[model samples]
Target: MVDIAKVTTELLLEETKTSGHSPLKFICNDGYLYYCKYLVDFDPNEINCLAYEIVSHYLLKVLNIPTPDIALVKISEGTLDKSKIIKNRRLCVNHICFGSKGIDPSEELTEFETCSSKRDYNRILNQEDVVKIALFDLWINNVDRGRFINPGFNYNLLTVRSGNKRKILAFDHAFVFGGVEQIGVFNSKMPFINQDKFHDSDFYKSFISYMDEEEIIKIVENFIPLLKISHKEVIDAAIYQLPDIWKLTPNLANRIQEYLFCEERIEKVKTVILNSKSIY
Candidate 1:
């Protein structure tokens, strides 16, 4: 199980601040930086969101996608005032922020800016070195309700520099399409064969070239254990803190289990991801 004690409001405050419409931050904790979103109180919707983020991150990691380090952590007692709570909620996804050294290659990187803006989109394209970030979103099903306009990118555009060179890093799997049932349909405007034109674009091709299928498979395999361990820890902590409130309903629990453990479905996803050359 993940150590819930490691996720505290004080730690969140110290490591980072809120961005977008939510009270979440890209902060650092326990040696890794994450994009943490805080919820003042818990609700079914919020719980689902938190669950999605954690599970999606795990799945993406398993799929060998370049996602950021992620986890769900609860704020300790009294860290936030009851009055300060936006909706009488508790629990949050403690997302680690990237580009702590401020070497992010995305031209649009900013402090405390919401990702759901056209201006931000323009900035992301300019600053983010990679041309295929949009493709990354499509690959992971990050689209929310078929509305691709607001696909989250704060964590996606992060880059690390090493000796006069910058490397592209991808993270943030919380918003993947399957997480929210409202947007899980595989609606491709074009068929698979014609998808090559989209993939051939300089931006798309370059990023695809950089990622080899075998490498991604290995990364995904390595991440499963880490995710399993983290989920057990988070769930155990949740049960301890709010036993009655956080207990997963039998149906919800089954859904979560299926999402996490169904190997055949995951393998199919892998096959699609590996064989598809187009981003659409």
Candidate 2:
């Protein structure tokens, strides 16, 4: 859990652009770049996707996976101008947002797909990071990376080569627990929720190929304890990260509570972890 209150940075809207609910790059008052996400408009589900981004970012950090540094940021009308608006509304101005510190600009970074296509394993360094991310995705039921529709193109995987050290990083986690597009189906935890997508898609299959049974079980051992977090804790963590002005009706907050922190939700996460046996 990214349970701590983050240092707030005002969005420098001039350098930012329109983006969806997922993490996007923005310049802030500190003269630094951050990959951030926020709740700008009202969605039917009332689930703030930024909650998942912050949660997963910290979780990955727990496993020693190098994720971006996460924080709570602020945006205001004074800082946000016309360029930052999406759908005719300002993007989270006067609201708290979720953000991850940008990877140092001087580091030599490349997207995973492009690097993989170029056989840049020398730069990718550790294959185990790949295993950790794959198993973590299974545990969280993240569909973003290895989607059936977009095979071989993993979003949010970056390879950084800095001086003599090489590393792999996992960034986006907004789709964990299948929270974004198909909340009900993923929340239900039906057996093999996207069976065809994970099985038939080359993207997910490639992740499986990198794993051995030993690593999968090791991750399972570490992952379950984190789920022991209570409903109140999860709700509080998410709420603490949001701006006051960002809308949060009781109904939506309640639904988010049920979907993320309830006992049933924990059980569903366990179910996904158990099913991951087939992944290796």
Candidate 3:
């Protein structure tokens, strides 16, 4: 079983002013701040986002992309109902919710105006991670981060500054597998395996110059092996470990794992990345 750290939401801070679903900011009992996504009464389907958040965090960690540490946040009874803000937000009282540990000295990547420039790229401590994250988004069919064509970039990326350099921390996977609504329709047969949702994004363009074709190929090559090792043991652990409150049913979970580790889909990740704009 996955040993996910657990914390209790002791106090409600305020509604964070950010894109996607606005998670409630809270200072958990651990004395650290976390942006917690809770169940909402308005739409039960939204809970699917929490499942996506937790699973994606695990998968991203496996890919070695930097992300905020996640926790299984415990919201004591009446925590949401007692809040004066609950009326407007319409949050439910699910005891267990997904919490992403807050990062100090951090801001969204869009806040850094120079993020598109070479000068900013030089200060990024882990510049190569940018390439890794882009590929991960494609593999998961995450259209929320930097969709250039229609709704525009949602700016899900975060930048944590340290001295003159900075680190990129990828967050917000609620929209993966198409989106919250589409989560139900997601199956192993979906065409996500060879999709290209990331390359056209400005997020990818910001670091495209820094990427070497050979390096991108090598990264995906390394990732393919991980999918094959103890298939049920590694991938199933992510599904089974999730709290039952999220409503990630056995049938849905089975489809998700199948979609994620499908033999044909697993092999297509490398091909999709190679077809993106040639770095040469």
RMSD of each: 9.5, 5.0, 3.0
**What's the candidate order when arranged by decreasing lDDT?**
3, 2, 1
Worst 10 residues of 2 by lDDT: 108-117
Q: List clashing residue pairs in candidate 2.
A: 96-243
1-280: candidate 1 lDDT, tens digit per residue: 3322343334333323333224433233344433345333323443444444554444444444444554444444444444343432444333221122122343322222342443423333222223233333434345431222233223333545444444545544445534345322223231222222222333333344445556545544553343333244343343343323433334443344434344444444444444543442
Better of 1 and 2 by lDDT: 2
Across 1-280, the per-residue lDDT of candidate 3 in tens digits comes to: 4567889887787876544566788788889998887765477777788888887888777767899999988876655644445432655455687899999878986632334677866888986677677667766778777654344555578888888998888998988888865757887787653333555566666666666667767776776676645345545676777777667644666766777767776667656666664732
Query: What C-alpha lDDT do the candidate models reach, one value each?
Result: 0.38, 0.55, 0.71
Say which prediction, candidate 1 or candidate 3, comes out ahead on lDDT.
Answer: 3
Off by over 4 Å in 3: 77-88, 92-94, 111-115, 149-152, 193-196, 228-231
Stretches of candidate 1 off by over 4 Å are 1-5, 11-21, 26-35, 39-43, 58-141, 144-147, 150-157, 182-206, 209-244, 247-249, 257-271, 278-280
Candidate 3 residue 217 Cα shift, in angstroms, is: 3.2
C-alpha TM-score for every candidate: 0.47, 0.67, 0.85
Which of candidates 1 and 2 is the stronger one according to TM-score? 2
- Native-structure RMSD, model 1: 9.5
Clashes of each: 26, 1, 0
Better of 2 and 3 by TM-score: 3
Best by TM-score: 3
Best by lDDT: 3
